[model samples]
Target chain A: MNPAARSADGSRRVLLMLLLPGLVALGVTFVLPLLWLFRASFASSAIGAFSGGDWTLSSYETVLTDPFYWLVAWNTLVLGFNVAVFTVILSYPIALFLARTESRWRGVLTALAVAPLLTSSVVRTYGWMVILGDQGVINSTLQALSLTDGVVRLTNNSFGATVALIEIFMPYAILAMLSGFGRLNTQLEEAAAMLGANRLKVFTRIILPLSLPGVLTAALLVFVLAISAFVTPRLMGGGRVFVLGTEVYNEATVTLNWPLAAALSVLLLVLFSSVIVIYQRALRALEA
Target chain B: MTIRTSISRRAAVASALAIGLSLLSPAAMAQDTSVTGTVNVIGFSGVFAENYEKFIIEPFEAKYPGIDVTYRPSKNSAETLALLTLQRGNPEIDVALIDVSVAIKANQEGLFAQLDPAKVPNIADAPDWARLDGDRAVAFSQDNLAILYNTDNVKEPPTSWNDLTDPKYKGKIAAKLGDTRGVILLPILTKLKGGDYKESIDPGMEMLKEIAPNVSTWEPAPDCYAVVQSGEVDLSICWNGRAQYLHDTQGGKIAVALPKEGSIGQTNTIGLVEGSKNKEAAELFVNYALSAEAQATFAEKSFYGPVNTKVELPDEVASRIYGSKEAQAAQMSLDWNFVADQYSPWIQRINREVIARY
Candidate 1:
């Protein structure tokens, strides 16, 4: 072989050597466990024991046929959409400011945006519980204002879970939205303004369309995260909101039905994969 | 039939050893140094884990210096059972502490060994109700369900379960909707209404629905204790031991009331893991844990109701535990094994019928 070709082959071998560890790690941790979960999902579980019996489609059948589980799935989907929309909506202005800011404190401001992610989710969930309880800050304030006769129910419902999730997911939305703001130019908005476009029109004609991909990606990220969220919903829902995530937990740990948990998890995985595919297709079409 | 004989035989052997050991001095009851190995223990986390380690475990290690012990804390009994089951093939945990229902389920699956009474003579000290699974597992502690009221918020502290449904408590109560406490509440309320739980828990379901309006939150985050102590809710239905602990720790912000209508005990059990490498050491640890000294110390400090009938506690502490004679008489005995079967379904009912309506 020629020297150049030989050099290229050696570089290719080195690249594979570098990639080998990650591939092996993924295979051992993710792929093998996934296969094991799939096999367990097919196992006919005893009511309150380790899930193992003859392989059957019973678990999946139960998940698909059970109207109760379907309702939980629907609730989870609705929650996911709400959390995604709210998180993205709340993050858009901040993300735009961060992307456009020429201030020296931009780094610190950006760090503040990501700071909530540093605290453990459990701690954050507990904080919400305290703040949203019956005689909590909001309720006491409302009562003091004579807004109503009694304390309003804030926590322990879908509303509480949605509110907490939007906050918990805001950082992720901002980061995803930032990726699409790369091509955003102030000159385009300026030119549109000079053409007698109002602020709203300028945003609609230039800034919004330019940043649409970021918004979509951010929404998708937050949606998937919200769908799989266990702690915030579990703590905030207060046993009233039975979503797919909480039900999966109840089935797995409380009921000792591992097979059913695995089946439900498989459904979640399928949902996530579909989301990823849709995301990719939309992005490709937008680019095309 | 065969299972019965082996269990009776085991019981006979345990009693026979107990009689002889009663003659020996207390120090002699400690195991011989020949059984030398590590006993891996698993149990609940938070204060329970800390106290278990400090009270029962440290003394167990000191009493039998030969057997080294390693403590591993888990989130709950369900998590412990998952660990025990996963490691069933090559068992890492020799002895485990779990809720009675989980223990019953674990025993059914043969995850726990038929605890050799010969090895664990203190098994005789456990009362009849506490001696579960025909001596395969025994309740080390009891947690009674009780009404926890905020001292500031609740001027007239509730004395009966019926009081919770009163108009005064409307939108001021926190309840565990479909958790273990809720499941156990069914039997208690059923008994109160003169209906057998096995026949039907409709009486309990109806009562819960009545109390639903008062329930401000079905899930109290960070636990029922925190919510009540903060006066976030006027009252809660929670475990007595933890409430008592919080009552003292929080300087009387919370108070526990064992309603006159009576309540049920949630038992925490310990047993030998099936595939333990150091069975003798593990049994020694289990025996030490069941001893009166260990039980009394643990009960005194942790406020967990000791299952050992021989253990003596203060009047106030005694009232907190279901172990005391008066409280024991007041408790409605639940067949946890049967309840284990109904557990998942009961949770489903509470969610679909009771909580859903509210």
Candidate 2:
């Protein structure tokens, strides 16, 4: 071999050695389980059939054809989209403030913004239940002030789960947006104002465009988390809401139908893949 | 006081005799330095698991110090079944504790071994109702299904199952759906409205559809017990034993009633793994677990009715459970083996037609 080829081969070997551990870890944790799941998805769901029983497409056929499964899928996507939009809307101001603020309390405020992430989502979901339950503080206060004749149903439904999911996911959006705002310059806003642009116009043209990547990234993060969320929906939806995540859990654990659960999971993976594809296209279009 | 004393005295005497007799034969079991293998077991999780470990497992370990008993807890019976089915033949779990319905499903898959009566003699004292899965598994505990109402909100406690659909309770009932609770509800509602659940859950489905609007939450947050305790809802269709225990723990804020039409019993069963290598030790654990002494202790502590009829509880404790004949009479008959088949299909039906539609 030529000297150039020898060096290239050595460098390739070094790269492989560097990447080997991560590749092995991913293979063991991710790839292996996925393969097992694929196998399980095809396994027979007939009476007393353990995972190795027989290979068939019945599980996939059930998931694809069933209107109930479609309803769950729709619920999951709707939750994801709503959570993403709301997270961005709710978190943008917090991120902007943290990025631009010079006040001494900015650090403490940022800390406060990120503090809820330290607590488990399960705890926060329960905290929401305490606030939104039928006889919870909101209803009690509303009744005491005579603002309402009867207690409004604020919880154990889709609305409550959505609200809680938005809150639970907001911190992630804020952090992501804050990181994206690293290159944002104050001079641009001042320069725009000097050129006779209004405050809203300056923000719309300069700031929003600069932070569009952040907003998109944050939305993607929140959307993915929201779709895959298990505890919050299950607890808050009160078994009334059937999202893909909860449906998967119900099939695997409650029904003890591993094949159907695996098929549902495979569908969730397909959804995630579609999201990644959309995200890439959107990012590419933005760059273009 | 007298009952407690007499029970304790008898228990003490029985233990003394048991220990004396344990060393001789296959009939009674004891351990020495030779029996040192671990018996890995999986059962219930949460508070019940902690208590079971402390009350039953800890004592079993103390009695047979050389042999180690490792207890792994799964979230629920279905999870256990998933694990057992996955690890079939090359079995890691020496024994399992699961709900009756799940136990039937697992046994159908050949996950559990047939119990030898000679090895575990305590099965003789248990009721015929407790023996299950063709002697592959036997019930150890029971928690009956019933009505639970918040004492503060409910001026009049519910007296009948039909009260769930009463106009006054519109949007005030916390109904637990799916799993054993939902499975039990379908059949009971079907029977109440003159239909058989097994033949067709349509009538029960219709009954639930009627009750759906009145349901404040088809799924209660945390659980039905917590919602009732916090006055989130005035009524819950839940297991009686937990509610009865909560009644005392939570300062009489809630009350459990069997309702005029009666309710069903949810039995928890224990069995040996079919391919367990530690058979002798596992059988010993099962035998010890089924003893009147072990049963009495768990019953006194857990509020769950003991399956071993030989275990005598105090009037205060017994009154709370389906321990007495009258309370047992109120237990509506259910074929849990049949439920093993109906469970998933019924949940899907109720979810789509009833929970989704309403």
Query: Best DockQ goes to which candidate?
Result: 2
- The sequence of per-residue lDDT tens digits that candidate 1 reaches over residues A1-288 is 999999999999999999999999999999988988888888876433244557888899999999988988888889999999889989999999999999999999988998999998788777776688776788788889999787788988888889989988898899888887998999988998999999999988899989998999899989999999998888898777888888888888777778899899998889889988988898889878
> Per-residue lDDT tens digits of candidate 1, residues B264-301?
87888998899899898898899988988788888889
Give the Å error, residue A150, model 1: 1.0
Off by over 4 Å in 1: A46-53, A102-108, B1-34, B125-129, B292-297, B308-317, B322-328
Q: Please give the TM-score of chain B in predicted model 1.
A: 0.88
Per-residue C-alpha lDDT of model 2 across residues A126-235, encoded as one tens digit per residue? 99988987778898999999999987888888899999999999999999999888668899999999999999999999899988888888999999999999999988
- The C-alpha stretches of model 2 lying farther than 4 A from their native spots are A1-8, A46-53, A102-109, B1-39, B50-70, B121-131, B288-301, B306-318, B323-327
For model 1, what TM-score does chain A reach?
Answer: 0.95
Query: Model 2 over residues B1-358: C-alpha lDDT tens digits?
Result: 9999999999999998777757543433644555567889899887678878998998788778877888899988887887887788798999999989888877777788999999998889878777887788999988778889989999988777788889899888988777678888888888888998778878878878888888888778778898888887889999877787688777998888666666677888999999899999898889888888788888888777788978888877766665345655656657777777788888888788777766
TM-scores for all candidates?
Answer: 0.89, 0.87
Residue B109 in model 1: shift from native, Å?
Answer: 2.3
